[model samples]
Target: MKYSETINSLIRKGLNEVNHSINGHLPLSIRREILQTINEPCVIGKISISCALKVYPIWNDFFKNDTEIIGLIKQSEKFLLGQINEKELLGNAEHLEVFVQDYNKEDNIMVMFAGMTDVHAAYDVLTSGGMEECVSDEEALQNPDTWDTAFIASLAYNGGAVALDAINHDRNKEFWNWYLTDCIRIAFFNDKLPYPPTTSIVSAKYFSGNNIKEYRTQPNIWKENAECRSRMNDIKGILVKIMDITHWTKSDFYFYHVGTASYTQVFYYKGNELVKFNLDINISMYLSRKVEN
Candidate 1:
């Protein structure tokens, strides 16, 4: 598809924005607009699914016969389409959470990156949230679900880029810089959400008893949509804010886990002291911010 001059300009701007920054986001006004339009929790879940599919090849091959991840992805999409209730979806998410916790992928960077994408997809249960934030350039909204969702989306979309960075750790090349320019990911333009790809992963052999297409959760989207929109708009009107602390620990091995503050940690000796570091969605951050105002 041909990009309009405006979109081409925006893409170029996005490229430059990520060129030197550790983390960046669309402007606050634009982000707010996106949050406004996405009142349906399923919409946010769709965002997560599309991002997760970005590294589908890596995920598909790395796990071989273990189709639990694909099953989870399929379940998630089905849930968004009203094929499953929240209780059932939560059960599936818990099962995937346990699977991710048991799998060990930290030994290989490629597996680790792709594995993280799966982990993030499971977390995209889409009981979504967006906080009403204070007026400050330092913030990109601090709601727990939204902040964590942002991180989840990043890992899903950038798993390949991160794997490339690992491969070229010694060569000092930035694959992320080129990854964005090489292809125009359709998800960035149009969305086929709530529909996981009808790939080989969903063959009857893989889908089997897990299929729930015939039993929609039967939500009344027409009535719920109005309520959700009003509620989300109220969240936007909030002035609550958040603050968090970055922390580190010491360990001699690698560890990875999913759900809640899911994290990946690798230890390296800093002059004889092995240290591990990670970011967390500390509730204290939000509590402190809310208390302060």
Candidate 2:
């Protein structure tokens, strides 16, 4: 009847539904492990049981559509649970070849951004001279539609001064300036922007030296910087590092980074324990954006 009780009831219901859905498919031990994970009170990465339940229908649709992959996942889960040996798991994996091909055919930006593998693919395409082929610096400066223009605009619209500070404070000031300038130059030659305008738009004046100074003098930027600093400092027992892309999926730490950024941070727990932190690029950008206002 009470609000807290209602939330607890919902969580229980969601966990029951998930357990029932996977029942008789995966090994009992595997199911139990998954249920334990789903029932955790705190967040995993950014995913919570409440959020997972709310999005169940969408994920269910995918499960139904890819029964083969689901089967493989079940087998994989069994292997992970020690119900099956590695040899047995590899035997089951052979059948995945056909399914893997079909799955690749359905790939798009949304899919690419969802998992670790796809994240790497997206990053590679964006950084491997593909971005340069799309827009030029001169064109980006002149046209609002250019990727360069939109990237700068997006930073400004999203809080460029804050973001600049995040990068400078968390990383280094020199890297921040280089990144900003490089993005501006690349936007000019870019034929298409990778992300939608709503996510990447920013003002042109922020790129100008005099305008940047005036913009930084605003009181709001300082306020935001203070708030962000407090939040970062509050994350005790977690160490953030900017490292190469290979570190994204490391088992020892929770990884977060924007593909556009040169490096990603691996956040390690105090005692080298594993935590199910979700890899969220948006959150990474937001936290990092809090640099010296």
Best by TM-score: 1
Angstrom error of the Cα, residue 149, model 2: value is 33
The digit string of per-residue lDDT tens for model 2 on 11-122 reads: 4443444344411111223222322333321111111111112112222333434344334444443443357675655555554443333443222211211121211222
TM-scores for all candidates?
Answer: 0.44, 0.20
170-261: candidate 1 lDDT, tens digit per residue: 11113333323432333344445433344444322221234411211112232457654554344333312111122223233221222223
Local distance difference test, each candidate = 0.43, 0.31
Task: List where candidate 2 sits over 4 angstroms from the true fold.
Answer: 1-60, 63-66, 105-293
lDDT, candidate 2, residue 160? Answer: 30
User: Model 1 RMSD to the real structure?
Assistant: 17.8
**How close to the true structure is residue 229 of candidate 2, measured as C-alpha lDDT?**
53
